[model samples]
Target: MNKLQVEAIEHGTVIDHIPAGMGVRILKFFQLTTNGERITVGLNLRSGENGTKDLIKVENTTFTKEQADQLALFASSATINQIANFEVISKYHVELPEAIDEVLACPNSNCITNHQPAKTRFYVKQSDQAPKLKCQYCEKSFNVELFSELN
Candidate 1:
């Protein structure tokens, strides 16, 4: 029997354990493909028994702490591995940010952010099933999934 392996990056970041359906969303949400960097994506990979996960490897590029924190909205269980010289230099789980600004639009159509020129902001509130984001403008709370790009 032989096991397959993904080629390791010489230096970059690997995001692992993303929820199966969220990988593509994360990639687009973070604009990971816009920089012309080599990105290897594995979707619906085997995880634990009867479970699936997604993994992404970005070659020669690294994410900032802010980006990592934002990833928590998409995949809270995701882990970031920083590799250098084909070795992992650091590994950590993404943390939910206290407040997200200028990243997500308020779900409320009547929100001030929708009409006026303003930076969207959301205060994070954790729930049993998913995180809630409260709009700074409309004061309405919505599940994280309701958010999209401000533009």
Candidate 2:
């Protein structure tokens, strides 16, 4: 089988090994639109370890620590590569933070974080299949799907 290759970005960040079909979710997490930056996405790409994966290249854009940490909710095994002048300058894996505040909203409507003027805080529970989040305000445990309902 022939493999399609995505053009190498001159400078920016390449996120590889994303969970298959989750590229769009990552883009949404970043709130990135196609109009502003040069972005490339490859979905369901073959991987040696993982059966298939997704790849995203953002030209002239680099992710912040908070952004990278947020990505760990989905793309835990993903690698971020810094490319400069078409050469990789650095490579690192996304690390999930112990806690994230205000990034994700608690799904419980009656939760204090949702009703009051307080930022939602979550204690991240790491797992290979999915990240489990416990709302600090309501003590409600939910999965990544609930986390996507960020406010």
lDDT (Cα atoms) of all candidates against the true structure:
0.88, 0.83
Candidate 1, residue 107: the lDDT equals 78
Off by over 4 Å in 1: 1-4
Give, for candidate 2, the lowest lDDT window spanning 10 residues: 142-151
> What is the TM-score of candidate 2?
0.84
Write candidate 1's Cα lDDT for 34-82 as tens digits. Answer: 8899999999988989999999999999888887888998899999999
Could you tell me which 10 consecutive residues in candidate 1 have the lowest summed lDDT? 1-10
Give candidate 1's root-mean-square deviation (CA, Å): 2.0
Q: CA shift at 121, candidate 2, in angstroms? A: 1.4
Q: C-alpha displacement of 149 in model 1, angstroms? A: 2.1
What's the number of clashes in each of the models?
Answer: 0, 0
Residues 28-65 of candidate 2 have per-residue lDDT tens digits of 86665544888899989889865999999999988787
Clash pairs (backbone) in predicted model 2 = none
Candidate 1 at 49: error in angstroms?
Answer: 4.6
TM-scores for candidates 1 onward, in order = 0.86, 0.84
